[model samples]
Target: MPATPVADPFDALDPVARRATPRVRIAVGAAVVLFIAAVAIAALVSSAATGGGAQGTIVAGGGAPATDLGVAAASDGGASGSPRVATPPLLVHVLGAVTRPGLVELAAGARVVDAVAAAGGFTAEADPAGVNLARPVVDGEQLMVLAVGQAPPPATGGAGASSGATADGTVHLNTADVAALDTLPRIGPALAQRIIDWREANGPFTSIDQLLEVAGIGDTVFSGLADKVAP
Candidate 1:
């Protein structure tokens, strides 16, 4: 019989082939691991860029971090959140016999004495006795300080001291005491006190019409007094 085909048992043990097969498998496994890692890294970077993470990140002006952007926004909000405070002053007109007579600004609840003091006090010729310094000053009211020995102007236009009497006779506004003032028509004790108070606060009245400026007196009361009272 023909010699049987020679069996080469060492073919399976070829050194180069054995070593190269294991090396190829190891290289393919390492390449797959590296590809997976690259994909994961790319996903992380995309999420951060789009601000999709729980602690969102922002690329601000000049590529500033998210924290810096938040801080800047907070600062701006704080600056505009506070409110401003304001307080208005009272304006008054001070006239006659003061060293510096004109408009003066005073705090609320200021008195006539405070206004006079603001106008450099009274001049030596000023008659302080006629002015009630303790009176509370009203806005837009003119304060006229009288000069000593000055005579008040005569009443005219039927508004001056009465030349005729009404049964009990007319009472003088400048000279009348509280009891005397109460005798005129519609003149009660309270109204009388107000008149006296007004006369004391302001200097002697130059005309009966000036009575209208008193706190309590109005057109109705003035008309009633017009026929009977004088400056």
Candidate 2:
């Protein structure tokens, strides 16, 4: 018997099935599109993650906390503050009618009374009336307190009120008592006292020229006494 050709039954029912395996081809095309879309979405997600990580690393490395800097600065400020230096003490020679007479350490601007107090106060023979207790004592000064009716030494600075004339008739500016200072023809008792006060308050006279610096001594008085005095 001769073989006859068979008709495809799916082509009659579905027009879209015109090509061989048309349904299968359509399904494969849709799957390929979906895979490409998924790949693209994954690429975008990876790029986003990489960019975010790099940005975080940069921020962490570059930005230091402000609080840490402030703390460091405050600590440095405390260490750099100024330091305090102690004041140097004064050295005075306390002498005469004080209970203990010797070198006494005192604060600056110490007065005679303070010096006396440091020297164990006055002795029974300390003629407080003879000394100017309120006067400010200087360094290396000899402070002497006389007994009642006791005469002051020739060159002594503290508590000496009388002027003494030298045997040679020349008065020493640093050593002469008030009496010797008054021996000048133009100088009197008041002027003599002024000279002693000046000598005591100021340091010893370095030169006879310093006589003019005395309160009562003018150029004329100094010139007259100049020839009669020595340093």
* Model 2 bad stretches (over 4 Å): 1-84, 156-213, 216-231
**Could you give candidate 2's per-residue lDDT for residues 1-231 as a string of tens digits?**
887868767648665556657678889999999999999999989989887445422224444354365564476564334754566766666666889989888887888789889999999987787656666665655566666666554533333322334555667777654445655768754576677788878988898888788887788877788777888
| lDDT string, candidate 1, 140-215, tens digits | 5556666786543222324222322233456667765443465566765467668878888897878989889877
For each candidate in turn, the TM-score is 0.35, 0.42
Worst lDDT 10-window in candidate 2? 155-164
Per-model C-alpha RMSD: 13.4, 15.4
Q: Which candidate's lDDT is highest?
A: 1
Taking all chains together, the TM-score of candidate 1 against the true structure is: 0.35
Q: Could you tell me the TM-score of candidate 2?
A: 0.42
Residue pairs in candidate 1 whose N, alpha carbon or C atoms collide under 3 angstroms = 160-230, 161-230
49: Cα error in model 1, Å: 49
Measure candidate 2: CA RMSD. 15.4
